[model samples]
Target: MSSPVAMIPYTNMAPYRQLGAPRDCRFVPVVPRVSIGALLSGEVVAAAVPVGGLKALEGVVETVGRFGIAAEGECMSVLFFSCVPFEEMHFPRTIRVTGESASSVRLLYLLLGSIHGFNRLPHIAADGRVFDGELLIGDRALVKGQATAGEERHFITDLSQKWFDIHRLPFVFARWVVRKDAPGPIKSAISDWLDEFKAREASLVEQAVPEAARTLNLPPAAIRRYFQVIRRSLGERDVLGQQLFIRQFEERGRSLLFQPAP
Candidate 1:
């Protein structure tokens, strides 16, 4: 049988495999924003796609919300700026990014600009050369300070923390979405598999990274945090949180889903 495809950036997805899940479950790690566009366009099928993507594809009927990744107070992971003293930021400047991320980067901007009250700074995609501040999410954000005690300057704005502060609940980042046209058995199987996988994440993380020392890099640690944030952001089968998130989609005023699958 062909393996199921899991698209997300978090590295803590291994537990799903360990828990008698499909070995064929191929994980396609991607940034939240753009990936959702592609998924809604039918470029891809199932993914832990961003909330933005979920908004685009709403009413497709096959998709559903799940889980939350909570970061109470301040998440040490998912740092926003690459430099210091966030209150005093350079404005009207173009910041360079690696050109791989989409959602978190923009989401960071909204959180800082719209909510946190920072001046709008345009993001310029550059091949190389670090800017004064850069938003680093997933594994990189978790272990960013490891190299030589801060060679790179970063102001840690925990996205999840800010989200909870505003929403009074966990922020929903992504969801497990099945295609509307997908077979019923396939959807049911995936649903069952996800439930089992969710239960096993805690035990897996314990064995996977028993010591916090191993997490100072953007590898496994970031992956762990990604899972952590996602789990916390979702609550009560994500019914209430999803309704709130839907408004965010409306605010963007973009078509969340493609007419036909990409």
Candidate 2:
């Protein structure tokens, strides 16, 4: 059998690898946490790794081209649903979080701390009944974002948009990455796909929407709006955002991996 690649099970991610990759590129649906394990264990050569967790994967894998999921202002997914008013939120209280993307959760914490002056940010587990807020990511986030009523909309915080509001830089959520020690064929295939994707991303993503909409059970227009906000290729500002996020993550003492104490 051919080598596999990890695919994060998110509707927003449909514009990436699903658009087109080599026939040898067998895709296996994996979540953010397990993706690294799959890549390192040789279960997969490449994965649509989370930018939030990028610091963790350093030296283990390298990002490919500018191919990634980024948002200039609003991601429309990766939302924080606060039980109380946005301004009234203070995190001595625990917030229920979906155990999905650590990256998104971290971004939430960063925003809560930096922008909101909330130093005591603690995202509790899903089972916790006593919580001040709920963090929803991926497709469910999109649904809640879409289905929200007038006043309810005031409470939902879009993490990517919040980042842009504070930093004025595009926020990248995930990117295609390959193991540094991956087989030549795997790396070469990803490189070739990146080359092909350079020009085709805009058009290909548009064309793929109907299918993605059907598969994801979201409206085609909603999908279009999402793609409108989502930038598949990272640019200078996007890189800046990544750097700032890493710096902040590390400074907050939430470094992804172990390091020597200085």
Candidate 3:
């Protein structure tokens, strides 16, 4: 008998889960966007991956314009930025990153350089940076936040909100993708799973770490509201969201020759 697979939830994966059970499959806890490069490089069959991973796939994708994880106005959860006052954030300071996130590192850099006009910051692994102010994402955001908040001595920015403020649209940090030659059935299954995941998010929320509530300093009710916000934002087919994503990325490409902000 095959082993029972555990379906691990991702930050942006709720939409997939809402689509429902696969006919003969058990989903597992594959993290977000980490698999994009591998899948496109033919290292894996399929994955929900970032566009950067797509570019890293060694000339596999000729054009990356058709698909991505964009939304119209305020995704709320993704794309975070933190900093001290311009006076305090020692210029040429080494920025530490939460080690777990593969996607946000690139996402953070693009938003900063493109949207906020910040240039020339070096990336250092989490352990190497001794400073209290550093960008973090995923489980670490919940796990280590309270201990570091305010005490870190910096002004925090949510890149999603900032993007929304600037352009009045949602940011698409990544996308669900497969190799161009991948089997059609696999793509269909993945799409179906995403639909079910979005529809049944309430069920998933119950299984979430309660510590997240305390860590975010939100009550359970507020946590539920937060998830609701994510659902509402992602599910909408708002033009504003897509426009924001395309405009920023295209503008950057024109100026910096960037591939995509995955």
Pick the TM-score winner: 2
Per residue, candidate 1 scores C-alpha lDDT tens digits across 123-226 of 44344644556666655655653342345454556676766677765555556676786566666766776766667668765555533335434455545555
CA lDDT, candidate 1, residue 143: 61
Candidate 3 Cα lDDT to native: 0.48
RMSD of each: 6.2, 4.3, 6.1
Q: lDDT (CA) for every model shown?
A: 0.52, 0.76, 0.48
Q: Write the per-residue lDDT of candidate 3 for residues 91-125, one digit (tens) a residue.
A: 34445654444445555565556533544343342
Order of candidate numbers by TM-score, starting with the best:
2, 1, 3
TM-score of each candidate structure, all chains considered together: 0.70, 0.88, 0.65
> How displaced is residue 33 in candidate 2, in Å?
2.6
Better of 1 and 2 by TM-score: 2
Q: Pick the candidate with the highest lDDT.
A: 2
Q: If the candidates were sorted by their lDDT against the true structure, best first, what order would they fall in?
A: 2, 1, 3
Candidate 2 residue-wise lDDT, 1-262, digit = tens: 6778888878776776546655577778898767867767778888877776676777889888877778899888888887676555554556766677857877877777765564445446345266677788888888887877356434788888888888999888778899999878879898887777766778777886898788767799998998788887789999898888878888874542211111
lDDT of 3 at 123: 33
